[model samples]
Structures are given as structure tokens and as C-alpha cells.
Target: MYLVLIAWIYVAFMMAIAEATSPVGSLLGAAFTFLLYGLLPMSVVGYIMGTPARRRAIKAKEAAEREQALAANGIQNAGGDDASVAPNAHGEASGHTIAPERKQP
Candidate 1:
């Protein structure tokens, strides 16, 4: 991806040089050509292509933070199989449930 961007920038720089050296082209035109065609489009493309890597980095950071919090709480192997996880220590239903009512005879 970066290789393609570098090649495009090189091509644009050459085009800008030609435009600036042309008798009918102004330096302002060359500058605008470089900015609009070369830098602007490539920068946008780079940002778009980098989105997946950014997301992966964010996920890794969050996982590391979670592991650190678990370690601080003296928990280990939190990601292991279900048997490693303990059941609710309180040994009670967590919320109230309504008992079924009997129909009137």
C-alpha cells in the first residue's frame, strides 16, 4: 500500500515539475496540482487502508487492560475453560421470580 502511495507521489512530483517548467504553466498551478492530486488523495487512502490495523490495536489494548485489572484482583487464568470459572458464591437466585398462580375452581 505504502509502495503504491510512494510511486504515485513520485509521479505527481514529476508532473508538478513539468507543469512548473512549462512556459504556459504557473508555479501556483504546479503547487495546486501536487496538493490536490498527490498529497490529498494518498493521505485519505492511507487513512482508509489503516482502519483495520487501528481497530486491532484498540482491541489488543483493551484486552491488555482487562488482563491487568484481573491480575490486580488476584484472578488468574480467567480466559481458560468454563471449569476454571467459579459458580456464584452467594448460592442464590440473583433476581426475584413470580410463582405461578392456581386457577380458581
Candidate 2:
């Protein structure tokens, strides 16, 4: 029980740090870390699992942003409508629907 409590506290701290460093919804890494650590009794296993999980979460977030950008730029389909695509305050595509330019302007 004590170990579990300690693990929970550790997870909370890690998650708080993650949340503070990244943008919105970036604390998923900490949540995943906490979950995995809480589920497993071995600290070694928790560390191994948590590391990759955090990395995967970050990669997934980046990929999502990239996709949104592509959609916004019109390089990719925005699910068939402008409304479906995320738009900026000015109603321009949020760049998720459009592809990024490879060349410098």
C-alpha cells in the first residue's frame, strides 16, 4: 500500500511537470505514466513502460498537429467540409487540412 501511494505521488509529480512544460492536452504522458506505474509493482518495469509511453504520447500529439496542419492548408481533405476542419479565429484553415510547404518563402 505504501509503495502504491508512493508511486501515485511520483506519477502525479511527473504529470504536473509534463503539463507545465507542454501545450494544451500535453499532460497525457503523465497520465499514462501514472497508470502504468500504478498497475505494475516493479519500479523497473514502470520506468521502462513509462518512458516509451511518454515518448509515444508526444509523437502521437505531434502527428495529430501535423495532420491538422495539412488539413488546414487544403493539402489533405478536411473531412469533406471547412467546418469539419479546425479553423483559426479568422476562419482560415488551422493548417491541419493543408500540407506544409517544403520550400522557404
lDDT of each structure? 0.85, 0.65
Best by TM-score: 1
Query: Where does candidate 2 stray beyond 4 Å?
Result: 1-49, 77-105
Residues 1-105, model 1: lDDT tens digits:
899899999999999999999999999999999999899999999999999999999998987887787678676765564253545546787666887799999
Writing each residue's lDDT as its tens digit, candidate 2 over 34-74 gives 55655444556557657877999999898788778876767
TM-score of each: 0.78, 0.30
Q: After superposition, how far is residue 62 of candidate 2 from its true place, in Å?
A: 0.4
Task: Mark the 10 consecutive residues where model 1 has the least summed lDDT.
Answer: 81-90
